[model samples]
Target chain A: MNAHDLIKEAIAEKGKFDSVYWIACGGSMIDLIPAHELLQREATTFTSYIYTAREFDIMRPRRLGEKSLVIACSHSGNTPEVVEGCEIALAAGATVIAQTDNAGSKIDSGKWTTWVYPWGEGVPQAEVPAGISLSLAAELLDQQEGYVDLADMYAGIAEMDKILPPAREKVNAELGDRFAKLCQEHEFFYILGSGPNFSQTYGFAICSLMEMQWQHCSYIHSAEYFHGPFEATQDGVFYFLQMGSSECRAMDERALAFLKTHTDTLMVLDAKEYGMEAVPASVRAYLDPVLFYAMNCELRAARGKVFDHDPDFRRYMGVVEY
Target chain B: MNAHDLIKEAIAEKGKFDSVYWIACGGSMIDLIPAHELLQREATTFTSYIYTAREFDIMRPRRLGEKSLVIACSHSGNTPEVVEGCEIALAAGATVIAQTDNAGSKIDSGKWTTWVYPWGEGVPQAEVPAGISLSLAAELLDQQEGYVDLADMYAGIAEMDKILPPAREKVNAELGDRFAKLCQEHEFFYILGSGPNFSQTYGFAICSLMEMQWQHCSYIHSAEYFHGPFEATQDGVFYFLQMGSSECRAMDERALAFLKTHTDTLMVLDAKEYGMEAVPASVRAYLDPVLFYAMNCELRAARGKVFDHDPDFRRYMGVVEY
Candidate 1:
């Protein structure tokens, strides 16, 4: 079934839901963030949350029951924690929608509905994990509370299919060499982002930079940077800012202005600079994270070439058990 | 009014509420996290969230209305962002309970209710910001969905009043010199914690270590460390784990065990090792963060004395305009 149909069926089976939970781990969890942010910003009838799968399984929120809708993702569909979370949600009689790139894996063993998206080359933008999750959220919001810009959000997703490739190429051509140089020069960095875009900032810092390249980094919310993290700013410190095209842009701009003045080693990737005018303004904020995700992948690849470290190399991750 | 009485009055005036938002910034924001976690874990009738004041003010959730309850804190009560959030909540017709150390400050200028907690020496444990916030959450849970362990929670708070002073003294005597030495030896550290204790982990890393002492640090959720951040863990890297006495303690222990193998420079502050045996097991987890907060203050002070950097010293906080 399509994403919308799956959401509609889930709602039909449950009758109504007062809460929605997005559960996953690592980059999968990060991919679900913008969708959770959508519900947080728009849905008045229901509350939503993003949880790391292991924490969700351990904490076991008391609200996870028949009236709850849980949307979970695991790239391999085999992450033990996410699979366990799906089982728990199913046991609570919640409507569970499991999204995965791997079909017929452990996650598919559950009684919940499954949506499989393509993982490799030439895949449609909407077929990616983030796109599918956002579509599910938008569909649920529309079915439950009537999202006014649901059509526009779909249009934004379509526009992404056309714009993201060029956008990634542009990022590689414009910022790749500089990013690679910076990676070579700095041993550590502070990444700043706000609103939905902070998910990409975190993914790029922890999953890409730290996990892939073994770089030390910290991701700070643009607004919260002013509170305490900004105190660590100085001439020698490195800062990378991901500027968003949303209501929270003010916070990002504030951080950018401060970083520009305080540090010489500051880099910024502003979504507005990329060609996103084809996307609707109403849905542009939600799409900013998608664009940044593509750009981050390009930048990571560039850094990998310069450092001679494969972005896919892992020291412990599938290689050894914790 | 007392914290519980204030919550009761707010609910009485509102008639009913489906959501609660805890809004603040910096340490004030961190202090509210345990309360937010309490609702997330126990209250099935209502949903709750923690938001940085600026983000809450800007994003302005559509759910903030007559059926919404907002509890905000600002240490001095004049934090512009939090004051703005209180005003926004009031304007939306949401019931607002504003907690502050300074009673007559700007937050009190709103039509919302205000609860004043003492800030200085000899303050009872239950009269502090974290304690008051937790009490408000517990009261709301008890009134809304009947929290079974409400009395035990209060008893735990009373027990804290007796145990915390000696706990702080013990932390200073046992770990002070070693922590100071580590601070001098290491230029950066990763602070790890899970469940509600992660709030203290974040508060210590960002607010105390980085903001006050100009140290570089990143706060990693213990469960999340295995996902990506663990790849950056190695022998020369420093790690400080805050072990909780709760369901999520398993995650902390997992991270601790892995860190012990991967890095020689690791420190752990385990709540179970302290004198928390007298606190009810059911409520002990909720108070773990409180104990860790006090312990962190002691450790920060020890480092401060070693480096001669006053814990209150700030390069930018109130000194410069952002």
Candidate 2:
């Protein structure tokens, strides 16, 4: 089955269950947040548990009577913590599902049910696995709002595809050199997302990890920025604000104003000014910002491969087992 | 005035009012959290609003009341945000009390009431003002708790004074080098706390903005970690877990075990291991952790200054309002 159908089926199955708990680490868990919100709004308590897979065995909540469904994700199924978590949850009498790139890997080796996806030979490196997996899990959890209609999501992806050549040119030709120059001295990034784009911020953060670059990113409410943290924004702070929604218009303006006054290194993607307005609102929320993120991932990967020659490269680092 | 007397006078004068809202940035806000808990326990809903000074005017909550109190804090008395918040609160019909340092800064300039402390040149720059302000605020809001034989608190602080210096030496001597080295490449830190320390984690996270060096630092409950974000620890995500009580002890252990398998960097501070046994068991619930926190603050500041400094540092570049 295609990725979309698989997710829809999972969501349908999850909807049939009375209680659902999602457990995953930072990178994979973020994709589930949007759907988790939908579940909560639908009156499903929808608790999210984020732990190291190894901790899963000890921290698993006790109420595992038949109705609970546990969904775990790891791009590589070999992570030790995830493996341990599955063993503990199954022993505790809860049904477990493993979502991974390699279906036959050890992550799905035990009593846990498994979902697998194809990523071709592109090394499954970069952003695709996480995006697909999270989008799938979100669907399984029945979390898609009207905002992510399947047709529109695909169309949005298509829209992003169209912009890729020019966007790449604009970013590489102008922004890339600037980013590379800045990143050389700066070891961190603070990515801010507003409205629906916050999910993209979470996703973008995860991809950074996948690319094997150590960078910090935060997903904050635009409105909350005016609180004290704004004071911390200095020359070293790189602020990435999503300039799409009217609800967050004030936040974008405030961030713009702060960067104008307080700090010097401000990497902003003024989506409106960039002619990115052609993308539909719903899909663009998930897709457009990623265009910038994709470039970031490429830059970092090239940096690591060409510049750093990180010894841990290429060898999958083979999933971490708890 | 002595800390105890200053608080008593402030509370006595401010208590006559119908409501109180503690306004502050991160560290400044934490001093009031414990007291707020006491007040909230007493069923006093003071409409607490925590925001940056600039946003205070923009996102100010509903007018607290004609007799409401706005307790504003700034260690320097010069932090632009607190000064602005004080102005806004005073203009909004709320009584403004400035908990700050020195006599001449803008935060202390207007019709607002001011509680100033003599600068402690002996203490570290960022902390001296904060410690005094926090101690005073704590004493003020919980005068009953503060003076309920503060001879014990004095002893506790004194004992803490003795214990922390050595403990800081021990942790720094043993783990400091490792942490500094790890931090050089691993840029993200996810800190976890549970139960009473949940708010403590929140406050500590605010203080961590210093070390974040623009990295993302997030703190969540131990229980919540298992649900969604746990899946991301495939290659062993780095994390810090704060173990406060026996209840959350398992979670801490689980985290350590998981980190052992999954992520590259992990630090777990278990109070049981920290010789907190010297603290009176009766008050250990609060004193042990609070005292440890006092040390953590010291250690973090030392570490930030020593290792986390951006070679080139600048402030307030993101966006700010005057």
* Highest DockQ scorer: 1
- What is the CA-based DockQ of model 2? 0.09
B-chain TM-score for every candidate: 0.97, 0.72
Q: Cα deviation in Å at residue A247, candidate 1?
A: 1.0
What docking grade does candidate 1 earn? medium
Fnat of candidates, each listed: 0.79, 0.06
Q: Once superposed on the true structure, which residue ranges of model 2 sit more than 4 Å away at CA?
A: A2-15, A37-56, A62-65, A91-95, A120-166, A187-189, A194-211, A214-226, A236-253, A271-279, A282-293, A305-322, B1-205, B208-270, B275-322
Query: Clashing pairs in model 1?
Result: none
**A1-322 in candidate 1: lDDT tens per residue?**
6778887887888786988989999899999999999899899887798899988998788888999999999898999999999999989988898988888999987488888788865787788888888898899899999999999999999888888888888899889999999888888788999888889988998798888888888889998887788988999798989998877799999999899999999988888888777789888778889899888889989999999999999999887779
lDDT of each: 0.87, 0.53
The stretch of ten residues in a row with the least summed lDDT in candidate 2 chain B is B40-49
